[model samples]
Target: MKKLLIASALLAASSIQQAHAWGQTGHRITGAIAEQYLSEEAKAAIAALLPNESLAEASTYADEMRSNPEEFWQKEAGPYHYVTVPKGETYKEHKHAPEQGDAYTALKKFSKIVKDDTAPLSERQRALRFIVHIIGDLHQPLHAGDGTDKGGNDFKLEFFWEKSNLHRVWDSGLLDRRQLSYTEWTEWLSEKITPEQAAKWNTTDPLIYITESATIRDTIYPEGDRLGWDYLYQHLPTAKVRLQEGGVRIAAHLNELFAK
Candidate 1:
């Protein structure tokens, strides 16, 4: 029992250290919103795979697994959370080794697993969780990083008088500042998502999502190191929209994958 407690504490510490994308609350918000938009067919399929788990419950699985001591989780999966596209270059123009996977490649790989009927149930479940998580990650503009700065993780700054990096600020600082539960965020964002907005955002193209994020990322770096209410006031709306889009796109991708 003591060993188990120690292991749990280690995992918690690892999660905190490796957090590079939307934090738990942000990911859960996207998953909850995705659940609201799922088609009946998609809903049934997801229910079969996940059983008792809702998308919101499954959303953080990929990030949580980062603490696993396995090589795949420790190494290979590290690059799956974000993509690096250099300034003035599109993802298409940026070449990377096939083995050195990025978010774009990882998304395609897991997406295929999720849609493959013959894949093992556990594999499919993991793929589903990754899909939920990665979509949320892609929406966090910093995750669509420039070639430098490690997705803004290296771009250190002070946020609300606290020492934080640009990536961390986008990941949790802005959203957490609101102090809303994931459910409340879901409800708040859902009310603002019109049918037309949903229709437009329900795009399954990962390239579009990545490009949109990169475009936002390029513009978000503050002129100076210190960021307070003004920075939050300027960027929070964009962050909310990205979360909304991530949720809508997750449902769209699942609906297409499970379509009869």
Candidate 2:
């Protein structure tokens, strides 16, 4: 019965991946950065989003930064993004079915620090950079997860050949599906970016972005009792689309944030 229960739980958990909070298509870029906002690594992950002076310059900047990251990002990051979230708190959702941890609240808190001129330049710079990175994270379906799971980590499934957890799928599995480099993929996805996307991605309200991604979460995958290559095949495009959107939106937001 224990084994049976375990299997049953796995099956039930499998269904959870396709649910609204778990969205079916996964596209996560995992590194030291991923969802983290504090690590020096996180700041490094987003260096590509910073200003490049021109598209030609952007490519040059990306090339130089990736090739010689130590010098570039060290020169770029602020002190605040280096500090971890205060103890006993999380960016996780922990609330009733109707209401949860406020993502907007989180954003406002961070933004105040960024906008505050009195803060040290390092802190302010980190805050600005993190705001750009978090907006990208906020759009990922699982990041605005349902309260029961740790951004879909508890949910499990099989992808391609191996058994995997739902959160992991979004964290890297699906994003890996496209063999193309980020630049190639960005070109395909950005072509369709609408004026509406531009207007919407500019919203600095963290809660609003959370709600927006949460709504997007619903359209991402199949319901319960399903997850496999077939599902992945059908949904991987959406994963690419989200990453593409996030990358473009990142560029847009950074451009606007610094333009100010």
- Top candidate when judged by lDDT against the true structure: 1
Q: Please provide, for model 2 over 134-189, each residue's C-alpha lDDT reduced to its tens digit, 9 standing for 90 to 100.
A: 55556667666655555566776667767876766665666566565544544455
lDDT of 1 at 107: 84
lDDT of 1 at 126: 94
lDDT of each candidate versus the true structure: 0.89, 0.46
Q: Estimate each model's TM-score.
A: 0.92, 0.55
Clashing pairs in 2: 104-207
In model 1, where do residues sit more than 4 Å from their true spots? 1-17
Tens-digit lDDT string for candidate 1 (1-260): 99999999978656444956789999999999999889999999999999999999999998888778888887678778887778887778884423768778888899899889999999999999999998889899988788687788788899989999998999899999999999999999999999999999989998899889989999999999999999999999999999999999999989988999
In model 1, pairs of residues that clash are: none
Q: Estimate the TM-score for candidate 1.
A: 0.92
Which 10 successive residues of model 1 have the least lDDT summed? 12-21
